[model samples]
Target: MHRVRVLPKYLSKRLDRWRSTTFSENREWFSHLASHGQHPRAMFISCCDSRVDPVAMFEGEPGDFFLVRNVANLVPPCAVNRELHGTSAAIEYAVLVLGVSHIVIMGHSGCGGVAACYDKCEGVNAEWEKNTSFISQWIEVLAPGYERIKDMDGDRSERLSAFEKEGVKVSLENLLTFPFVRAAVEEGRLVLHGVWADIGSGALFAYDGSTESFVEV
Candidate 1:
């Protein structure tokens, strides 16, 4: 039997090189950002999945988007709560404080959190139950898309794609629950978008409000 090396020397050297080059190249810009705080053009709500990095997916540079990530990227309706919640606080700060022009709720294909909501499990953690309550409660959010393609599905891949696209619409509807977010859109101060990214095909889909359809972005 052969044992694999735990930490490769080249990996560490590469990280060191990146730290020096990336930091030096953007040091002045980062310093200005720190001094003035983030004045981002958009706020992106996305899942906490390690594979689904919004900045990398969007090809964004530093301070380009005010990002919030959670188990499923589900935005709960804004309400006063005693305990400190990072996701909600981030949303409030992005909308009210930072005054972002756009709020994009991005859902992706092959989301473990969303899949978990559709399946039953045992010995689930209390924290998971607390955080994922919205996901279970909002089953209607993903139902329509599933229903639409259930009978006519060409293959497993096609069905899964439909499900992910539907989930985006569901999440977009959920975003309207936040009064500040809704009011901002109504007042023409903000715009909302539902986006789906297919990891298998490396394709990006954007929801067209007028046609109520998802188009490649």
Candidate 2:
């Protein structure tokens, strides 16, 4: 027995508004999705930041993408163990079951998770090291990204921007650690993309493997 509460009033009203407007307008589309099932072509891995909405950013519809969001948009290395892995499970389903052709890891500017990792590594934040702090451990996944940018000659903001993009690259590498993901890539069945978004400026960048850098897109 757990305490479950009703939807908040504001959200409830929003749901009603959606039902009357968006849902009503797209009833057939929704019905078709329900009947035929979703067949999204790409799987989008993105941050849980409210400002970063993949659907709106990509101008995509409901069944266009299988989306997985987490703090810092981090992907941990695949490991065999008894512990539950939510993100890994989502990746497995997206690749094997959905058979998506592309997987995108999108990082964003002003990410609090990335900022926390930056502070943690710089010894500016000790709260993340506490035994009871789950966030502390989760953001540790970005430590490798921090390492890549720590010594770079730049101001705080510049270093943070570099670190943010590095986090996307780190996730791309970790994505390959999954044998299924690697096999799919090698077999030409799937593609992996790294992207970063600047929230304030609405600018996007994509990693260009040829240049080994992120180029504005």
Candidate 3:
């Protein structure tokens, strides 16, 4: 029989601390939430990067945001398919069921997924990203954004940063294609936001639809 590995002692200790302290301090709130269910105000879609902490970025409490983290923070246009679609399913639940008023697509600087998409679209032939790999296929969703900036007159890093923000634009546009999302927004019940973070400096940029550019927030 294959034995299941237990949580590491050190990591388990962290949970113990939370249970003993954090959970204890918020026991009443926890009990209420457990009974009433989550009613988050926002749905935050972000890149699955270790440095980009959605909670920390927003100083959020538990159940404050319906969070979905995926590669490059890319949102594919709404599709009905038999194949398992974790990202799309989460968005549907958040928008249609949870009734979240805000959808924030958060991307960040120095994102590895963005870099992979840039390289793949640029035909760099990276060995780590075989075309058949799951990551390769997932990152392909950002290919259009990469293609948009792959030839722009800038250094590789600058172009990569542009690509990251472009991914946010793509996601925001894609979110509207969902009928539920569009209905909610049109009824003045929902708002969409695009955010990019400079991971190195801990700075955030918000998309300004006015200028079609990101500005420091």
Candidate 4:
């Protein structure tokens, strides 16, 4: 196993304090959630990056949102494939079972997976790509944004940020691919949202339904 460092005395103390105090403070809510089951109003599909936690970003408590995290936060259209179906399963449960009224696809800046797609990393073999074929195909959603901004270069950071935001819009569109999700939206039972988080600045931007553009949250 890759061992993580546990040095830094001040950080260690903070961790200990969080474990002891935070766990105790939050345990009651956890118990309540387990007893009553989740009654979340929204389903959040977000990136698997440690820095982009949906619960933390939304200031949500347990049972507040049905959450799904995956590479680049991509939601594949419901397919018959028997392979990994974690994201799809979560969406099914959240929408069909839990009856969440809103579905939010949250993407963020400084996304390694998105960056890899944009850079077109070499040395990745065909077999490896086949194994992770879903990721490769899903990341293609951002191709338009990449094509638009490939030449305009001032800061790589800014360009990547734009790509990340664009990816959120792509995911929002992807959510409509599922028939159930589409029906729900058509009936006004569910709403879809795109959100972009700025990791560098700790700022959030959400797609405005009226403007069809990302605005500060």
Candidate 5:
């Protein structure tokens, strides 16, 4: 058998410090969460960018939000095929089992996944469009958003910024494609939100469905 890798010293030291301080200070709260189980108020679907931390951004505690992270924070339309759907499965559990009241899909500025999708849709990056890359297929969900903004009059950076926000809107729309999610939303049991983050400036913009635009939050 192949030898297993050991944890790096830096990471091990950080864990030890967390266990000694943060964990020790919050032992009772952690125990309560373990015994009572999670009942998150919101389900946050966000990008897998290292700079974006849902808990830190929201100042949330354990069991506060059911967080799901994926490329570009894209949510594909509901498909019932036998293929494994980890994100969809997590969404299902969050909505049906946990009964989360809100679902937020937050995309970020300078998203590599969104950039790749833009490149793929524009027929510019043959490498990203290759069949072998899982990422190439995953961000295909953003194709519709690309179609909407591809012809807009803007520089590359501006278009990309719009595309990132558009990606959030696309995910929100896809979330509604799930019948259960739609039903819950219609029945007033759940609400959906789309947000975009400017990582450099620490700015957040929330999609206003009424205006069909993202406004600063």
Candidate 6:
């Protein structure tokens, strides 16, 4: 027989509170969403950072964005392999099935994942890297940007900040490597956007293609 444990007391309390305040207050909206499948306009790819709340930052409502979060907001070049690729799968679904008009890769300042790449460059072991080592593999997507930024003149902090933005650009490029994404973008069916969040000041900057740089939004 299978068994299921009850939610912890604190977690149950939290759930009840959320239901009362957020869910119950919008029961009709939630019901409509449950009846009709989601058709979000954008796919928001962001880092798995607690402080980086894509919905709140963008003032998005439920079903507004097809969201995918991962370390450093990294998106690997599309590849077909036996191994399961969760991020790529999300991208495929968002593009092919959901038909999201835009894909936004949002990176942020003081990102711990980006910091880990600097650690790798400095030959320092990130705590998670030592035990699982999968983190290193995942962070590998940002490796090229780290290599470019690390050698640049400036303090380590400045280099890391530059890398955080560079990581967004890298992900944007990687998105193009996906055939479906590339086709959609080429045919004017979709748009690719790169954004960086200044976590401390709550400011967002978007990559401007003409300048090849991020500008304040």
Give a tens-digit lDDT track for model 2, residues 1-217.
Answer: 4688888999999999999999999999999999999999999999999999988999999799999999999999999799888999999999999999999999999999999999999998889878788888898888988888999998999998999999999999999999999999999999999999999999999998788899999
Model 3, residue 73: what's the lDDT?
A: 88
User: Residue by residue across 85-179, what tens digits does model 4's lDDT show?
Assistant: 77888888888999999999899888987786676533344532554676676666556667666776668778778778777777777678888
- Residue-level lDDT for 207 in candidate 5: 95
Per-residue CA lDDT of model 3 for 64-144, tens digit only, reads 999999888889888898877888899899988998989999999999988888888888867536857888888877777
RMSD of every candidate to native, in Å, equals: 6.2, 1.1, 1.4, 4.6, 0.9, 2.1
lDDT of each: 0.75, 0.94, 0.89, 0.80, 0.92, 0.91
Per-residue accuracy of model 1 over 81-189 as CA lDDT, tens digit each: 7955576788778889999999888888888666654342222434334645765554334444455555764765565566666667766776677888788889999
Q: Please, what is the TM-score per model?
A: 0.76, 0.97, 0.95, 0.78, 0.98, 0.93
Model 2 residue 12 CA deviation (Å) reads 1.0
After the best TM-score superposition of candidate 3, give how far the Cα of residue 98 lies from its true spot, in angstroms.
0.9
Return the clash pairs for model 4, or none.
none
Model 5 poorest 10 in a row by lDDT: 1-10
| Sort order, lDDT high to low | 2, 5, 6, 3, 4, 1
Clashing pairs in 1: none
Clashing residue pairs in candidate 5, if any? none
Worst 10 residues of 1 by lDDT: 119-128
State the RMSD for candidate 4. 4.6
Better of 2 and 3 by TM-score: 2
Question: For candidate 5, lDDT tens digit of each residue in 1-217?
Answer: 4787899899999999999999999999999999999989999999899999888999998889999899899889899999888899999999899999999998899999999999998889998877899999899989899988999998999999999988988888889999999999999999999888899999999999999988899
Q: Mark the regions of model 5 whose C-alpha exceeds 4 Å error after superposition.
A: 1-3
Q: 3 or 4: which has the higher TM-score?
A: 3
Error of 2 at 93 (Å): 0.3
Superior candidate under TM-score, 1 versus 6: 6
- Give me the runs in candidate 2 sitting further than 4 Å from their true place: 1-3
Listed per model in order, the count of residue pairs whose N, CA or C atoms clash below 3 Å is 0, 0, 0, 0, 0, 0
